[model samples]
Target: MSRARSHRWLRRPNGDTTPRFAYGADYNPDQWPREVWHEDIRLMREAGVNVVSLAIFSWARIQPTEDTWDFGWLDEIMDLLHEGGIGVDLATATASPPPWLTTAHPEILPVTASGETVWPGARQHWRPTSPVFREHALRLVTTMAERYAGHPALVAWHISNELGCHNIYDYSDDAARAFRDWLRARYGDLDALNSAWGTAFWSQRYSDFEQVLPPRLAASHPNPTQQLDFKRFSSDALKQYLVAEREVLTRITPDVPVTTNFMVMGETKGMNYADWAAEVDFVSNDHYVLPGPQSLDELSFSANLTGNIAGGRPWFLMEHSTSAVNWQPINRAKLRGELARDSLLHVAHGADAVCFFQWRQSAAGAEKYHSAMVPHAGADSAVFRAVSALGATLRDLAPAAGAPRRPARAALLFDWESWWASEQDSHPTSRLRYRQEALDWYSAFLALGVRADIVPRGAALEGYDLVVAPVLHVLPAELAKELTAYVEGGGHLVTTYFSGIVDENDHAWLGGYPGPLRDLLGIRIEEFAPLLDDETVTLDNGATGTLWTDEITLTAPDVEVLATYTSGAQAGRPAITRRPAGPGSAAYVSTRLGAQGLTPVLARLLAAAGIGSELPEEARGHVELAVRGDGDTEFWFLVNRTDEPVRLPGVTGDVLSGPTGGGTADDPLVLHPRGVTVLRRPAGR
Candidate 1:
């Protein structure tokens, strides 16, 4: 039998001419007085919020006791929303369980790797493997699905809130047992498991399945391999939870899409989005851009990654603060035009819909200060006006903006397992950070106005002309094979410090520093020394910089040095080098460099690979370019994300701009800040 479709994802149902645009914010009428429901609906309609995500944290009200469920309030709320012509993205109400449920079934609560049982207060506090939690949670979802499966306003089913809470994996006895079962099913034999884990080194062999325990803070070894295994296990455990919940929801509403919101690039949680993609219908993520120009690169990189996760499928901007977030160390409102700019950028990249974390600001709670469409001051506030303006724009531009677009010829490999393993290592340089390093490379590209895709290391490497893998610590054997093949097949590959150290199981590769990639990279690492103090590295090729000191030897005869360490004993040695594999070339950097030091080298490589940084020579300066292609048409978006007024380029006339004109190749067009222009070209150039 074919698998059931996830109901919380986007689906082009009935081939409707009016494309489905989920222009809505999260709603929690449970907290508001009953008298206010009508006003809220009216306000939502005014703001063009056609959909509202409801019941995200309503488990407490729905199941006051294990045997009793109260649906009277929910029925009224659903009816009200339906009457208002708003679609419903119904949440499973499993984000947080009620205090009574936890008190009655304590086993359902999650235990951290540190042995602390995560209590009932926070969201994502449930244990995935717990029978009680699964039984109770499934019942809730099943009942809701069955009741609302054919509801006119129901558009999708949100399975649960963010999968892993503070951290990934629960080390409860139940979780441990479930993990062992998962491993047994995956490897099929104890010998294979032992070999994969390299159990002989630390005498950590498991005599029986019962001896296995979930990787925990107490039992975790400093060994990179063990730590990496723990990371993988944690990711799998969390994925299993999502799959279980998805299975239940799909059974009830197979026609609708299903999804869960992801926190972008969070490392401590151990959720690898790529691993979760196959199970989800499409991906949705929360974009919480830090409040400053400094965070722009991070925000763009995250947006790029989210786009790639859905395989270029349009994703929902599930939750962003409409004004300011309450939880950050210093919460501040987004400057007047900043929020709109950020949201537009998401669309410029790959987002199909934009929504805020909340519809109304909370009056009492930890999130009371969190921004919302309507603040505590009510519907007449300035924040509400801003929201209303955005809604109006979305409604007007929905037809044009909702269509998809693909980016240009850049690709960055994001390996969550490698990130987890690299950090788990006890001996690697303490300065090494997985996400930060990846972000650094990504930022370099974005700063130069180069559009890139953030792909998993295992994604198909053929389409990309430039593949950059920075700090790829744990190289999955399959990915290693693909990388080698890609480089040998004439693609340019760039990798940096502390890469290829571990295998899939997170065990150190015994052969050399870059164990699996040593042959592919044509280098041998003789010794790795930590740079305890500040130092500089100068390349023989005129590039000079400071880097954590490490001495490496070139094993490949064809390799050529690019940069050398300046101060340490490894000074004048190759800090960076390139070698030809087959049809293409491979570049390796032995140490990390700041953005200034890295960007020039990256530009050189990109240029050498024949990738164009500048847009068509005829294009104007102020017009930022983004391109996405379907079968026969290439959609190009020219957006002015900057604050000042600017001119449009070439010929573009859609609803965004009032009229169309094909100017001479030399003529330039001007556009105001926050203006967007989309142009289309037929396929076959």
Candidate 2:
């Protein structure tokens, strides 16, 4: 049989020419009685849920006892859903191991950095590197694969529920040994490892591999080198578990795609989705933006990260609340049109599927108050109606959306090593956060309507016309070389303060400020000025900027001044500069710029790099822009996130049209409050 589309998981059966939608929400059958399955299926059908992710946390129910296995209930449920025309995204049910397994196999439990044994009952309590846990998990997966490998309803395999609920890496004996093995494989020798980690600095030289310990959070004076290693080790540790599970599923069910849902912008989870992307069929993410005024950016950034993980492949919005989420301190219902608009935004930003956390509202447990497709009363609530309407629209537009487009020529390099190194440095500024700085630049670019890709520093830098690396504290030697080559080859490069200070291990590089990139930037550091809380600085453009400086340096030449500290001993010094590097140009910001001060500067910079907003020049206000690509086809997603309707000059169809904008890209489209529209250019246009 011909394989399904390489990027999308086709929900419709082979030989069936009927066009079908491929989006749905997670269903918890175990939470409700079996009698409710029929009603749930009817409701799902009405809500346009063609696919249902099942048995995510059913490990305890499926195999309550160590040796016993039960698939009868799940089989019935899957069959019932299939009969109702809903496809299945079957989960392996390895998210939360049964209580009995932990009690029977105490070694399966994880130990924290402070020598605390994580008890049972909480989710993600298992030690990832523990052979005992791995063996049991494998058995669970293998048994499920064998049982449901050829099930007609199976469309995809969900490896586990949020792979890093408790941060996968542990310092237990099992994990420690595995860390050593991984290091050996990467470095090949103890000598190379020693030099990489700079073990000689603190008498930490390892004669034997056994001397190494997993980096803990509670170190008296944490070694930055050890900390960086720990981060990499933790990410790899989770990879081992996911790879093992994917290997088994792929072997038995090669036709079915497999994936694990990742959390957006989560650091403690120990999940490096970039590394996990290779093994997964497609990257999926759970987006839960805390209810607030800034929720739009939070949602957009999450979707952007998910898109990045799949290498621009359309991803699944695996879990989102239809209304209010109970986990936050203040749970506010998503405004009238927010849910529909947000869901469409996902599609516009390359989401193949949009699924919620639940099908029906729970009556008990921690997530009881969480929103669902069917509210607690099981009636057609406002959220449910909106979900149903969107579902119908998706079914009608399935074929058109099945293959969209994404075109991006700008990129922002996001490095976890650099983030860790900058934050963990016992250095000039304690208030410095790598993600915040990166987001500042990202927000600026997005506001200006630039389609930018968030990538790793090590990714190929040739294709991008403009590259932004903000607060890249740790410059991997190879990546530094690649960036040098990129700038030398006429690629526009922009970097902020605290960049290129250290190597991958967080150890400072000798010579000058931005040590590795100094030659390319044509500057060096003389001294660094640390500003007190909320200090203001003035730029050459007559804009005032804020500085929470803990360190400032002026040790460079051939730089044009951009900004200066308004009050300080170094009042007249340049806080930002630009210089020529070979055929291209480089810009450097010596300090963080506030919102008002940063946006215009970035707009000017991006324009100079030949990237501009696809939106009409007359468009204004809180607008979000995203581009999705499928071969030569491209789709432009425009979202007016404000409270008022905005009219655009371009002709575009309303992807979620419902008596709002007509379904044709003929005249100017008017977006209602919190409105989203996807405009597609026909292939080969």
Candidate 3:
């Protein structure tokens, strides 16, 4: 069977075939009085809102009792939206259960690793492995699907909101039983499970499947492989819940597509979304800007990864903040032009649908202070004005609605298994972070104005001229062979510290460090020399290294030393090495050189790989460029990366949307501060 259902898009209530961006927010009519809904729809039209994801967190209101369902309010709002020509991505309203259900069945509540029961005061308080929770949730799914199957305003089905957000690691008896069942399916027998988990260590072997338990709060660090498998099982358990809900939705309303929003932002790594993308009709993501210097870089990296997870197809931008969000420690309002700039950045990365967390600001709730399309100041506010202008901008750029993200010359490999395994206890430096290293590489690409794709581990590698795999600590044999083949087929490969050290089972490669790739990289390390927090090492190339270092030995006659250590214990030794393979080469970096330090280092590697930026020299670091299109035409999205205006030269195209401007042979195109401009140009430009 295919990995995912064919790409399905939202259609208008009138069934119009016109190509336009899906625009709106999470409409919560249930949060307001019935009389205020008319004003909501009127403002929606003014903002050019065509679609809204409705009833996401309305479970308590939808079902006040086990036998009672209050659909009268829902029916009225559905008819009102259709009359106003707005389509709906109708949610199943199972994001949370009613207070009555939880009070009746407290067994469905999750248990922490410390053996404490999680109370029902917050959202997502139920366990994924609880049969009682599934039975009640699926009943709600069935009722919603049957009632809205033929509704004119219905466009898609929004599944449970952000699965595994809080309840991912349940350690109750129910979860123990389900985890054992999952392990049986994976290993088949206790003997095989022992071999795979290396349970012989520390006298931890299990005689039968019944002896296995989650790596809960233990006396000391639990078995490493067992802990890794528990992480895997937690993600799989939630994926199974999503599958159960989707089966009912597809069975009742097969024509309407189904999707759940994925939180693909900073450090929310409980779900393996690449593995889950195959189960959905279309992929949708919720991204919020993290504060700091690398905030925009992190957003771009997440969007790039999400687009690749959808196989470069058009996906939905489900939820983002209009200004300051309530959840942050110090929620700062967005500066002028950031609202449109952020939305268009996602559009540049191939998001066809743009939406926020809500339509109207709340009067009373936990998230009452969260920014929305209509803030507390109402339609007269600057936020609502910006939202209206963004809607108009989306309409103007309708021609680029379904364009796929154009492939780039280089890619950064991302692995969820490696991420889960690399940071476990009893390993190297605890300060080592997998995602931060990957983001540093991405930040280098952005600084150099080089467009690089962030691809999952199993994605095709042959399409790129260069591939950078950073901190790929888990080196399963199959991936090892595949990466070797990629290099033998004339592809340049670069990897960093702590890579290729362990197998899928978290067992170290016996012969030496960098076990599987030692030969391919033409370098071997006898020991890892991790540095202290205050320690630093200087490289011969004028770059500073921190966190970790390796004493590398060249094993091949054709190996070349690119850079040498100058101040550490391994002074005068190779800090970076490269070896020529069949038609390409493999390189290794032994330490962590941050974004600024890696800029010149990457310039050299990019030069060797025959890849360079496409922007003008003067605008290389000042402007960010992303392209999206089918083969016949292209849309060039240029975003100003700094607070100052930039003059872009040597570009020619018809402006689709932006400040009115053009550049000639002598005159340059002007980009206002924090502005985004889209240009429609011919393909292969």
Candidate 4:
């Protein structure tokens, strides 16, 4: 299950063998006049641009009317970039179909749950399971691969841009047929399908496979298992499409690696990226900073998770913003020092390449206002200067390229199924956010200056001393056994409320709440006491709980109650509990205590696990530390998490690249507002 298959990297256009950080953006020369092309090359050299993803959304331009093909402009750009010593991640030009193709075959369009056609005014309008769409897309892909197979500027192949960003869930006939096939493969027979779906509950049992359809618009809540299976089928449908494109590219141009950008930021959780990680040559992600209180913490969490998805190997920061993005509710420009800070944070996690969405800001399209390397204000703007500065910083830190993420003593398990199932309809509480709970725990670790890796559910958990699985709601039998074995083999486990409540089939575990984990946690609850929006509860540990609370009855003699409710309907009851198993322990938090509230609780757990802050005590909350590299040397990325300057009393390392000041074991190092510093030192030190 390891995603360590890719050992290849971006091939140098000029064949330079030196290891260097990849720097570039998505190049869209077709949007502008031919004269601007030369100027783009000149500016690219000035800003240290090395690679560009080409022809991502150029399907219409590449195939004007489905009969006419245009490669003249593409040929010129490819030659021009090679002359300028730049490499190209050439796209398949299948992100969006030409208007003629869609107009001719309207069946290719996706349909909503209410049986409405998804119109094509925007991008990603084609359905993933449409055979007509696949035919056209594969034709375009084969043409591009054949045309650029021998080009020196060609480094990799970019599959359809952000595969399922908009059209993930299609309820059209094409989707229904594909969903049935997926279900047949998964269940093997009608009896197995009925058993897994619990179809007898609502007289939804099916005797024929043809009667089975997607969990479409229904009278009542669609069968929970049906909905879950549909989600799985949709993701698999898209993954199969990706594999189709990848197979073609690999067959034609076997040396060239292929990758698609994954949106792993915020709540864009439609696609299961952990499953898709192994399908690509290397994992690449497109992340945008969501404006919120835990914005930076969320960025770190996303990056950490992406790194682990890449199997701790160096991945790609395919697309990010140099300034404000146009898509948010109120897009605000990035504050000073934030541009470099954000890019470096991705590098700190495991990205060897740093790229933006577009090289030049658009002038007429929907994303015209989106920020770019060369913004609408041109090269003289602050954004361009910041981009150039980041380019220079990356060049100076070339030694950090190819370095793997340093594994932390602790890990946080992130499960996509848990996220999907826990937030489904008819749940105990609609206010619960699975990702936020995991991020809150990550923020708590940040607050305590303790590093924790955010790993996927099935990832190996043998090395981590303490594993925190926040709201792991969907627990299959095999996974249940795995967790039990992990704890019994001296791994400390911690999970939250609403976890282990259901198995893989979306059926309750039958015994009690937190069913499979009850024995390990040594606690049992009869039912859930979800809180209203305005409700609040106080815990004896000085933590405020919200969203949920559980009354627990300890079943093990060694189980200990760590915190109790002091002000709620369940007064004086257990709010947090822990049970020891041999040399290991399992803890449970029966209430939702946010980042601030979770810090104290995490401190206790970390102490018991013998893990402490790696940073100076004074710099705990203000500065974040991420390590990279292997045995002999470690690259420490110290990021200022605040807008104010942070001082570290005793930080020691050879300054690789950073702000003006340096720190010894005796002197204090001052980091500017939103600044980041990279230090290189012996791993032992």
Candidate 5:
């Protein structure tokens, strides 16, 4: 089968495709009375909502007792939605086990690192590795799948609601047992496992797989490799549950696409979605705007990351905020026009659907004040009007659905294993952040008006001219060899300090500062000089650097010094080095350069690699431009993140939304503060 058609769950056997942008929210009919549900569907139709996720948190209502099943209420709801011309992303209601299930099977409750039980006052109380929890969840999923196999209202089958949101890391005895079994299966023997973890240090060597345990409380730091393996196991444990539920769904209804919403935003970092992406028939994600200086930038980064996870195939925006979210410490409501702007931003980055946490506001719950399509106020409110307008705009963008992102010229190496291992305690500097360093380099590309794709560490090096690996603390041997071969094969390469030093097991390379990559960049680092909070370093190239600095030396005559420290004890040493590797080259940045300092270096690298920004000259400094192409058609997504009105003098195309585009090639493109425009232009326009 073709890759596109292999997704039989998405493209139904009847050949009905999803709308351009699936617009709706988590529809909890059980939260409201029967009278309110009719009005809810009416309002949904008015707002152009074609799909509503149903039965997400309805396990208790669906199956009240252990033996009894009550599909009458769900039957009415599904029939009502079917009559109202609405499609359903039918959830299996396996997110939170009901109170009875958890009460009867107390073994299912998760345990913390300190051996404290996670009580069931809230949701997501069950541990993923608990067999009792798995049994109950499987039964419920089977019942739902069998009951709703051929329901006309069913469009897509949502397996569970936000898997691993609260139950990602369980430190119970059950988890320890699972961890040992996982290790045994991975290494096949205790000898290989001991070698991988380098257990000879501190006399931590294990003679048997049963002796292996999850990294728990320790005097100093727990084994770093043990911690890394636990992180991998935790993600895989949750994925096992997802796979179990998916098996039930697919066994009953073979044509329905099965997926679980991933909470892939903010500081939540327990589960690895790249590994979990293969288990789902289609990918869906939940994201929220974080409160910080770089919130919007973080939003774009996450949306782009999710898009990349889908392999640039269109995915679903499972949840987002409509106004003020209730969970933040100081909840700030979004300003005017923020709703549509946020939704369109996701659409620009390959989201085929836009949805919110809920359809109507909850009056009695932990998230009562959380923003929704219908706020606490009546339907005549400003939030409602904006939601309706966004729905209409999504309908207008129907023609541009399923367009893949244009090939990126530059790639940023993002690895979850590295992210997990790099930030573990006892490192030279605890503040040597993995994601922030990559984001800092990413922001430089954004500032220069370029689109760079974040790719997996093991992804192919083809089609990319330049690749940047920032703060890659855990560098496996194979990847080091591949990157060196890439440079020798005429591909540009750049790696920063704190990288290429450790192997996959978190063991040092034993040679010099940079273990395997020392010869590739023709530089050897003697030691890392991590700066204090009050200290700074001045580079001779007229830039200030802080956080961390590496004392480096050029090892070969072919290497050239790009920058040297002007101040500090290691003054006059090479702070940056580049080596000519045949037709291409590799550069090493020995310190953390702030946004201003990295621009010129990146510009030089990109120029040497023959990659330039595609943004028009007039729109370079003012607008955020991202392009996606489908055959002869191209979509130009222009977002004005600043306060000034952006003017594109020589650009014109069919304006899909907002005020940045209109008319033919001679017309000037204009955008106001926070304004977004998606212009459709054919090839060679």
Candidate 6:
């Protein structure tokens, strides 16, 4: 069943015998006049929209009151969409419960860490552990599944939109009980729980399971183990909700593919999407371009991560903006051609579809200021023109949807447990950001036009020449063994400070820092001298360290220093170390390198590993290069994000977009500012 579902992921089922690649937006037909419904579909058909995600937040309108349902309007909405040759990714409409249900069962609402009850001014207010919430939510899912089981327009089932986006961790009494039960299932006994949480140190040992509670209103950073379990419980609790909804979905609409939109932006460590990927038929994600300097890099990083999450298969680009957003303090509009640039960038990674937030602009509600496909300026607007043009552009390249992403030669080990543990309070420094530290390395590879997949810690390390694990604060012994084996088998490794220092329960490894990896890295840390935010230290080898610095001493004869601190109390100590391990070598950096310093450090590592730049010096920083292939055909998608044109040398292929008759020996591909060119070639090259 999983294999069959995987086959249906990259494209619509072949049985449809129609044009593929879903292109549309979230449709809220209830927001418009009944007379405006036909015009909405007409404009959709005109804009080349073949898919519409219907009824994402219509629970109130659909149910209205207890013991009542109005499927009459939904019936017309589905029929009209099908009549216009548009497929429906029908939603369960359970994201936001109606006011009636919340008022009737107020206990279902979530409570924050400070004990404030979260009311229903916004969406997703119900507590996942509340039986009142669960009963009503499951009933809604069952009803929707049964009603749309055989509807001709129903192509997929979207379950509980963006599960746990607004309310991930609730500190309510219900959640406390649920957390205790989850702990019991994990630890099996109170004694095991007490030991794992290390209750003896804090005099907080529990004698009974009922004594446990969510880590809340703590005096000073509650037990780190309790914090870790709460994160785990929160993730698992949401997954349980998805499982319940899936049970109803498959029981009725067994044939309809099921999925939920995942908000998988950078550093979003609340929910581990790697585990959630297994619970769905096909992976789908919603990404909003971060409004800042590294926005483009972030978009690429997240899209690559999403594709990797889907296991190299093309996933859905469920939601993005056509222009400005409403949430950020300084909402900025997309520059000319930025929309097409952003959308195609996802496709270059592995998006089988191009979608947005809404079909029409909203004149009311919190999100009314958010951009849409059809702007308030009407279909004749420039934003609408760009959306229409992107639709036609994507529809022409439908054959590339099912191809796999080219295998990465380097892997960045991304661990969710580390992300949780690193941010715990009372750490060495609050400046140790998990995502930024990761993006620092990831951006280096991106800037050099080299592609690397963000892999989980447990993934096989046999495929890559180099593996990088940054800020691996808590290391399980099994993973430690795996890293050792990876280096012994001739794979290069790079790890940072505060790694291999503890077990999974936040218990420090006894004897010294980097306990299990000491021999591999050939270094010992006696103490840490974390620098203040404004302090900076230079290295003897021309690199600079900031944010963190550790006092290091060589423990092995073969260990070599790559950099040494030339300032502060830890002066003359090794800041970076390298040592040979069997067939390959392992390197460690004991302090965060400055932005300019990482370039040279990464250069030395890449050169040592025999991994070279993917593009020429001319094309290195000028373009974004990504490859997707199967064994017969390969596609090289080059996107030029800058304002200047980029010239590609020795490039000839079936140019998806360019002059007539495609590429020839006489002409090389040249991408204009913010332009995208997808060139196809034989895999034999």
Model 6 Cα lDDT, one tens digit per residue, 1-685: 1222443542243475453567999999999889989889889988889888999999999999998999999999999998898888999998999999999999999999889999988999999888789999999998888888888888888888888888899999999989988998999999999999999987999998988989988778789899999999999898888888887888887778888898878666788888888788888999999976577878988888888888888788899999999998988889887898899888888888788998999989999999999988989899998898888887777767667888778888888889999888888888788877777787778666677788766678889999989989889888899999999999999999888878988898887788789888998886668889789888997877888888887899998888888988788788888898877889998888743567678778888888877665677766888888899899878888688877776666787753223333366577888888887889746
- Candidate 2 accuracy as lDDT: 0.75
What is the model-wide C-alpha lDDT for candidate 1? 0.74
**lDDT tens readout by residue for model 1, 430-452:** 66677877877876775565777
Task: Report the lDDT tens digits of candidate 2 across residue range 1-685.
Answer: 1132255454456646564446788999988899898888888887878898999999999997987877899999989988988888899999887889888898888888877888876687888888999999999999999999878889889988888767565878888888888889878999998988888877778999888778755546666677778778888888778888988988888878888888874343356677667777777788876554446765776677677767666677888878888977889888888888878777766677889988888998878999988888675578788899888767755654555436468888887777767776567768777776777777776667666777765567788888989888888677788888888898989988888888765667887678888777767775455556766666557766555431334445656665665655556666666776767778777777854567887776777677777666656436677766467555556788788877776545434343344433455667678876665555434
TM-score of candidate 1 versus the correct structure, residues matched by position: 0.92
Higher-scoring candidate on lDDT, 2 or 5: 5
Assess candidate 4 and give its TM-score to the true structure. 0.99
- Native-to-model Cα distance after best TM-score fit, residue 215 in candidate 3, in Å: 0.6
Per-model clash counts, in order, read 23, 16, 0, 0, 0, 0
List ranges where model 5 is wrong by over 4 Å: 1-14, 17-19, 660-666
What ranges in model 2 sit over 4 Å off? Answer: 1-11, 15-21, 217-219, 266-269, 544-558, 631-633, 650-667, 682-685
Model 4, 1-685: lDDT tens per residue? 2233466778775567787899999999999999999999999999999999999989999899878999999999999999998999988889888789889999999999889998888989999999999999999999888888999999988899998999999999888888888988998999999999998897889999888888788887889999998888888899999999999998999989888899988998889999999889988999999999999999999999999988999899999999989988999999999999999999999999999988999999899999999999999999888888888999999988888999999999999999989999988888999999999999999999999999998999999999999999999989989999998999999999999999999999988879989999999999999999999999988889999999888889999899999988888889999999988899999988999999999999999988999898889989999999887999999999999988887787877788645566556688889999898988957
Q: What is the lDDT of residue 613 in candidate 6?
A: 70
lDDT of each: 0.74, 0.75, 0.91, 0.92, 0.84, 0.84
Off by over 4 Å in 1: 1-15, 219-223, 266-269, 291-294, 533-549, 614-624, 639-667, 671-685
**Candidate with better TM-score, 1 vs 5:** 5
For model 6 the TM-score comes to 0.97
The RMSD of every model to the true structure, in order and in angstroms, is 3.0, 3.2, 1.1, 1.3, 2.2, 2.0
Model 4: how far residue 506 lies from native, Å? 0.6
Candidate 4 deviation (Cα RMSD): 1.3
Q: Please identify model 3 stretches exceeding 4 Å from their true place.
A: 1-3
* Candidate 6 colliding pairs: none
